[model samples]
Target chain A: MSWVVENLDLIGRLTVEHLRQSALPIVLGLLLSIPAGWFAFRFRLTRGVVLTAVGLLYTIPSLALFALLPPLLGISFLSEVNLIVALTIYAVAIMTRFVADALSSVEPSVRQAADAVGYGTWRRFWQVDLPLAGPVVLAGLRVTAVSTISLCTVGILIGIDNLGYLFTNGYQRQIIPEILAGVVAVVVIALLVDWLLVLAGRALMPWTRKGA
Target chain B: MDLFADAIAWIFSPEAQSGSLPLSEAIWTHLAFTFVSVLIAAAVAVPAGWLVGHTGRGREAAVALSGAARAVPSFGLVLLLVLVFGVTHKVGASTTAFVLLAIPPILAGAYSGVEAVERRVVDGARAVGMTSRQVLGKVEIPLGLPLLIGGLRSATLQVVATVTLAGYVGSWGLGFYIVQGIQIRDFAQILGAALVIVVLAVVLDLLFALLERAVVPHGVAARRSAD
Candidate 1:
């Protein structure tokens, strides 16, 4: 308890850095994923190969990817670049599949109606296809956000500063209170992010709310 | 051509052979450590998940807790555990990390499965005066089994990656090879260890897929295509 009170500022700063590290990759990944997913949807084989590669990338341990980066890019903040690349690879794969599934779930008649109305492909995609797929896309985004938060913990192991550093430092010093503070801080951040995503999901797709 | 032959020759040479026992033995120990933790975690997670899904009480809290657990790195958690429980404790960090790993998937699977059970099927069961337990046992569990197993498969792979972290804490495992390979700059050993992890994860996922088919009614997996 005294540890928590004494180092409140440090802990707060750690949490903020952690959030910043996670936030950029997640937003950028999602933004990049949406269009790539849509493009892949139109080109089926390309989608399969890209997604499979991404899935394989997901299995590689984060530390290995970080370590491998130094040889290729001379390390530094470039390590974070590799981390984001690896994470984005995962996000794009998941979102691609999600987008495909959601699009398929859209009834055939809806597509027919869009065609009948003479809407061009791009306009129909933005207006009809995406809106119909909102719920699923939102769910995929939730998973991506959660995974990004989890993977950010690896940042500490690679000498990057984040809340995970607290865990490592506390453990090194055998200080239980400091370790608990880190764990609690991470848990709070995860929960808050999860709730925020859920609320955003609800706001975006009011239709899903009606059923539940 | 000579370089390739020399590399192969060295790989099968006497020194490598002498070092084989400790390396293979370490791998076996790591496997044991991982599987034991996974088994314990699965046992705890599965029951907790079923109960949470069955009763909606504290469902949000369970989800929140699982999310939080999933967010922290198992390696980091292991380090903390070693500090609190002492390094020699078998029930220390590895077990906690695996348990933490297991909770999220089981909870996600059980809750989503229960939630996804068709309303009509549930209503029909209730209309027949079926008890809640009967509805769950007879209808919901069977329906949810495939997706639940899918989640378990993913969680298992996660546990395997985590087991490699045990080396840092002085526990024996495949991580021994990975860390050693790094220290010695032996890319071949590093690749060998990583390949083992990949193969094991793929095999486990395939096995779970088969188990899902065997346990669930036929066509259920086909129906849950995205899962």
Candidate 2:
């Protein structure tokens, strides 16, 4: 308990850093997956190839990806960018499939109705397809957010710092409370972010509130 | 490019193949850890999942538990368990963590696989005088095999990746190279070991994909392709 109290400032700083690291990759992944997923969905020819390739990206272990990225990207071994880039890749790998599935889940009849009402391709997608797919996409985003936050901790092993520092430091010092603090902080952050995402989903998609 | 070449060269170098723990030994240890943890996880999870799915009870609990499981960082879990179990019992500690890490996916796969079977199909089996035991064994298990394999695939991949972290707690595996390399700043060793882990994961993933395909019921496969 004293360990946590004395180290509150350090914990707070690492928590913020962790959140910063997670937020970028998640937003980038969400942005990138939209187009990548749309391409796979819109082009039947590319669906198999794109999804397979993205799935392959996920097969690479997180540690391996962290180690390999430096050499592949010509970056410094300890560069924070490597972590961010790797996390983004993973986020994209996960969310693209969800986005693709979500887009496909939109009712064809609803799409036809939008088209019959003279909605152009661009407007129709914005006003119809994206809105309908929002729930699933948001669900995907929640998964990505939680996983990315968890994954960001792995960055500490490669010299990039975050809440993971506590795990390593606590282990070396055999400070059980410190280790517990790290675990609790991480789960709390994940659940908190997940809850916020759910609230945001509710706010943005009022029609989805019917069941609840 | 030169660094990658060096890593490739390092992987093939005599030093990598002839140490207290050779690359080959590390690979084997890594595989052993993955197999044992996954095997144990399946043993516990499959039965529980079957019960939940068959009885149509505790599904919400299962889903919530898996969701919570997914959020717990494997690295932290490994370290914490090592502390709880003591350093001398690192093997047990890490194995327990891996098993816990694996159960969620396998459980989800097992239960969901059975749950996914058409309700009418199960009813027909019952109507035809099949016992509950017979329905589960002959019907749900066979039909859910593909999804069960899928869950096992994810669980195996997760355990394999996590087994690397076991090295941080002084356990031997392919991750030893990565952890040691990082401490010593040996980029070549780190990259080489990482490549081996990647290859292992990819190979395992492909093998599981094949298993999933082979296990898909003929009717299910036909329906899928027809869709």
Candidate 3:
């Protein structure tokens, strides 16, 4: 506990940087995945190809991607920008499939009812499809957020230090308190991010609630 | 494009193909970690999972545990274990991390697979005076084999990906090539290592799919696909 107090200033900065790196990819992922997901759903050929490609992307280990991305993107290996690009690919890959699945999970009967009422594609998507997909999409976002926070720490090995610096340094110096602080801080961040997403989901889609 | 060609050349090069720490050795180390961790995970999860599914209890707890397990950053877990156990026990730390990563899928798969068996089938077995143990062995497990295999497939892939991180913690599997390549600015070696890992994953996935088909009761397999 005293260790935390002694290092409070360092912790404060790293925590902010950790959240910044993670948040950027998620926001970019959302922008990319929504339109791409919808396009895949709209086209039959893409349905199989896109989902399978994304699954293959997931199979590539995070460290492998961390190594592979720099040259592929023409960025320096140690640059945080390379880390961000890799993470964004991961975020988009995961979120895209979730976007498609969540949208498709809306009942066919409910969609048919909307169509019968003379609703056009644009308004009906907003009123019916997006709202119905809200819960599942939110759930995917929560997973993406937590996993990204954990994964972005891999950047430390490639020389782009974030919160993962704690783990690497603690291990090198054989410092128990710092290691404990690092592990506990990561768990806390994951929980806080998850909770914020849950709250955001509830706020956006009040229709998902049940009255008691 | 040249790096891709070089990676291909690197993979086939004599230095990588055969030496004290050859390509085969690294591949073996990787498979060893995966094989041991997964086998141990199955031994622990399968019986526990079967009992939980049989009683229809602890399913929620199982799901919650798996979710928490997944959220734990596996590389950090490796470091923690190494810190507690010391660097000399890198194998233990890496193996333990792989086991933790492997358990969720197997547990979830086994439980869901057993639960997925139709109640009528089990009841019919019971009506024939088969004991609960016999019913599980004969009816539920066979029916559940499909999902059990599915769980193993997922568990294997996760463990395979994670074993790469084992090298970071000092266990030097195929990930050695990637990490060392990065430090030395050897792009081909990094790509070579990545290519090997990807091929390893694809082969295992294909093997699991074949195993699932072979084990699943034919009619049940058909019904599942129909769904």
Candidate 4:
């Protein structure tokens, strides 16, 4: 407790940095996954290949991916972009499957109804399919957000400097409070973001609200 | 190109093969850690999950617990445990952390797998004069095997990846190279170590996928394909 109090300023800065690193990849991943997921869902021929490939991306360990990315992408070893990019790849890998599954979860009868009412492919997807898939996609996003926040701590190994620093630094200096602070701060950020996402989901998709 | 070239050379170098902690030894240690942790986690989680699933009790709590567990950073957990237990117990501490990390997925898999079995099937087993234990062992367990295996698959992947961090605590594993490389600013060593870990993870994942497939009952496989 004293260790955390004494390092409050450092903790605050690291928490903010941790949020920054995690948020970018999550947003980028959502943006990319929607299109990629749609393509995989809509196109029967490419579905298996695309999903499998993306799924394989997730099997690569985080530390390994963090280490390999800079060289693969021609970035500097310590560049923050490498971490962001690696995290985004992970986000995309995870969310794309969820997105595809969510879209598939939409009833065939609903699509037929949309088509009969003269909704074009683009309009049907935007107005009907997207809305219907929102709940499941949100669920996936929540998982991604929590995992990403937790994973961002790994960036400390490369000297990217985030709450994860507390773990390494605390271990080196034998400051248990510092390590506990990192863990609590990370879990708080994840839960807060998750709660916000739930609120946003309700706000954006009122039809999904309970008893609506 | 030079970085990759250096990494490739380092991977094949005699020093990497004959060092104080040889590459092969690191691989074995990583596997042993992963195996033991996951086995311990499964032993604890599986029955608890089965109890929850079979009796339809404590499920929400179990799920909520697992969800909370997911948000814990594996890195922080390992380091905290090591510090708490002292450096001499680093292996026990990290293994405990790994077991904790592995439990949620296995528990989720176990209960969900059992729950996925049709109510009618269990009822039918009961109608035939089978005992509760018999129904669970024969009906629920067999049907739930695939999902339990799936849970084990994910748990294995998580543990394997995490065991790499044990290197940070001065433990043996491929992560030692990454830790050592980072300290020395040896990009080649880091990359080479990363490549090996990636290969190990992917290969293990594939094996699990195959195992998951093989464990599925023929009737269940046929019914799934029919769907």
Candidate 5:
């Protein structure tokens, strides 16, 4: 449409900023989740409580979280910072569940073999558990990445400028062309990011290519 | 109960009936806005999804489209709509945006449901001389029913939560409480709004669970056991 062609560069810039803000929560969530996941598996009693808490975290509505942030932190991008924190809470909550599920899926024999070789708990985890669980963790990462991207769109509600701004503006004005442009740009970007993650997953764990 | 008392107190407070406090008119309007839009979305999304699933062409493309739909973000969509529609009414913008929010899950569910059915079952039905339409209606649909319901459940919860974003455009929902709460630093109102959302989610989820149980074909569970 004419709207898309006219605003191509503007759309491009909004998409990039959107990606940048979204990346923070995803990267942080993944980093925090991996360790917490490992810790959860190591500590049985705590695992249930942690996973339940994380599950609850996933249910918090995005707009409510955004509004709650401004009072606690003065009205600014710091509110955006809280939004990121809230997203990480949701991501990590879901990630931990996936991580635990993946870990559980590892072959019992392989774990036993690691123990038989006198590998310390940490060493065995790195040598065996992590590699075996890599595919599932990667799948979880993919979900978290996409979910974070989606949630970050809600960031616009709090005055953060992102790709969502374009679409929201277009929709508000009833300019179908601009709204279509925004939708196209977002869909293209999301697919690209998702495919890149899948590629990374395949490259990191070639064994996953074998059908389960 | 204390909770009831608090709710009544919150409802009766000068703040509740005053300016910008969304009361019955607002609640009914929001419910209509949300339920109607979601119904519209389902009407469009469900059959299209079934067709996509049945056809099985462009599976990856369809999935990608759903993901993109999910990523579009409601608030920004409404703001954009306000400019184009030439109307400042928040309800119109919110409804348009919520439709976008509601469609993807249902589409994904229906598509995946159709794909997930066992190939041999399709073949078996055909062997019995069932017409293609009959096979799809009797065999494939029943089998895929559970996943379709799952998708609806997820979609419904998503719409319920995202509908609040319409508040930014001036439509009143529980989100009204959240927005007003923040404007006046009313923590109880904020908490009440949150509690309402959580309760809605749980109740809706439970309702979907019952719907799924009621609707999933008996043969599908039997198939699972046989497998």
Candidate 6:
């Protein structure tokens, strides 16, 4: 408890860094994945190939991806760019699949209805399909949020600062209180972000609240 | 060419491939961690899922919890456990984190599986005066088996990734090779070890795919695609 108080400022800064690492990738992933997912949907031949590649990418351990990215991308191993780039790739990998799944889940009748109303392709997508895809896409975004936050902490192992640093620092010094604080701090950040996403999801899709 | 040659050389090296703690040992250790934690998680998660699905209780909370569980950084959790307990039970302590990671997916899969079972089937069983146990065993279990196993598939993937992370806590696994390679700047070992993890995860998912098929009853298997 005392440790948490003394190091409160450091923990706060780390959490903010963690949020930046997570938030930027999720935003980037959302932007890229929408188009990528639509391309996969529109081009059936590419669907199997694209999804398989994404699955393979996701299967590679986060640690390995971090270790490999610097060499592959010709960046400094210790640079923050390596961590962000690897995490962004991860964000893209899962979000693309989620986008595909969300779009696929939209019923054929909904598409037919849009056509019946004389909705054009792009306009129909934004007005009809995109809105309908909200619940699922939001769910995926929530997952992306949670995962990126967790993965951010992994950077500490490779030498970046985040709440994960608390664990490493505490472990090195055998300070149980600081280690406990790190665990609590990380979980609190995770839950806090999760609730915020939930609120955003509900606000965007007021339809979901109809039942409630 | 060096990476290729080094990879090839490392793959065929007898010492690296066979020892008390060789590549095979590392793979085995990784599998052991994944399997043990998953087995324990299933025991805990499946029952909780069953109760929730059966009674329509706590479903919302379960979903929330699973999301929270996913958000807990496996890497940090393992390190904290080791810090608190030292390395006396590295495998056991690491398993705690893996178990936490495994439970949520399995729970969700199972709950959804049970929840997905057409209510009429359950209603019919109840109308016939069957015990709740009978309905669950004869109807729910068979029908929900696919998703329950699907949960296991999700859990297995998580555990595989997590067991690799667990290596940082002195738990022996394929991750040790990756960690050692990272420490020594041995790219070949890192590549080889990373390859093992990827292959293992893919193979396990494929195996679960088959198991998902075989575990369903013939009647449900026919309707599987329809569902």
What share of the reference contacts survives in each candidate?
0.34, 0.76, 0.36, 0.78, 0.41, 0.51
CA shift at B200, candidate 6, in angstroms?
Answer: 1.5
lDDT of 1 by residue, A1-212 (tens): 99889999999898888888888877877787777667666688877776666565666555455544444455442356666665666666666677767776777799889989998988888888888888888777877777777767767654568887787788667788888888777766776787898898888778888893
Q: Per-residue lDDT for A1-212 in model 2, tens only?
A: 99999999999999999999999999999999999999888888889988999989999988899888987788887879999999999999999999999999999999999999999999999999999999999999999999999889998888888999999999999998888899889999999999999999999999899874
Best of the two (5, 6) by DockQ: 6
What TM-score goes with each of the models? 0.81, 0.97, 0.91, 0.97, 0.78, 0.91
> In order, what are the TM-scores of chain A for the candidates?
0.89, 0.97, 0.93, 0.97, 0.91, 0.94
> How high is the lDDT of residue A77 in model 1?
28
Interface RMSD of each: 3.8, 0.7, 1.6, 0.9, 4.7, 2.0
Give Cα distance to truth, residue B215, candidate 4, Å.
1.1
- The whole-model C-alpha lDDT of candidate 6 against the native structure comes to 0.81
Write candidate 1's Cα lDDT for B1-227 as tens digits: 33334434544556544575354565567667667766776677766777677777778987776656666757667777777777668456567777677668767877767767888988999999999999989888888887788767767777777777666566366665656665676655554555555656556666876887787776765777858
> Which is superior by DockQ, 1 or 6?
6
- Please compute the TM-score of chain B alone for each predicted structure, in the order given: 0.83, 0.96, 0.93, 0.95, 0.85, 0.92
List lDDT for all candidates, in order: 0.70, 0.93, 0.83, 0.91, 0.73, 0.81
Clashes of each: 0, 0, 0, 0, 24, 0
Report the lDDT tens digits of candidate 6 across residue range A101-163: 888888889999999989999999999888888888887887887788888888876778888
Per-residue CA lDDT of model 2 for B100-138, tens digit only, reads 999999999999999999999999999999999999999
For candidate 4, what is the TM-score?
Answer: 0.97
Q: Please, what are the lDDT tens digits per residue for candidate 5 over residues A1-212? A: 88788888888898889888888888888888888787677678878777756755565577666644544455442256766777877789878888888888889999999899898988988889999999889888887887777667776655677877765676556677876676566656766787899999888888889877
Rank by TM-score (best first):
2, 4, 3, 6, 1, 5
In model 6, pairs of residues that clash are none
lDDT of 4 by residue, B1-227 (tens): 78889998988889889877788999999999999999999999999999988888999998898888878999999999999999899989999999999999999999999999999999999999999999999899889988999999999989987888778887499999998898899888899999999999999999988988898888889999999
lDDT of 3 at B47: 87
Give stretches of model 5 more than 4 Å off: A1-20, A35-55, A67-78, A104-122, A159-192, A206-212, B1-14, B17-25, B88-90, B183-188, B213-216, B219-227
Candidate 5: Cα lDDT at B3: 39
Sliding window of 10 residues with minimal summed lDDT for model 3 chain B: B66-75
Sort by lDDT, best first: what order? Answer: 2, 4, 3, 6, 5, 1
Q: List the residue pairs that clash in candidate 4.
A: none
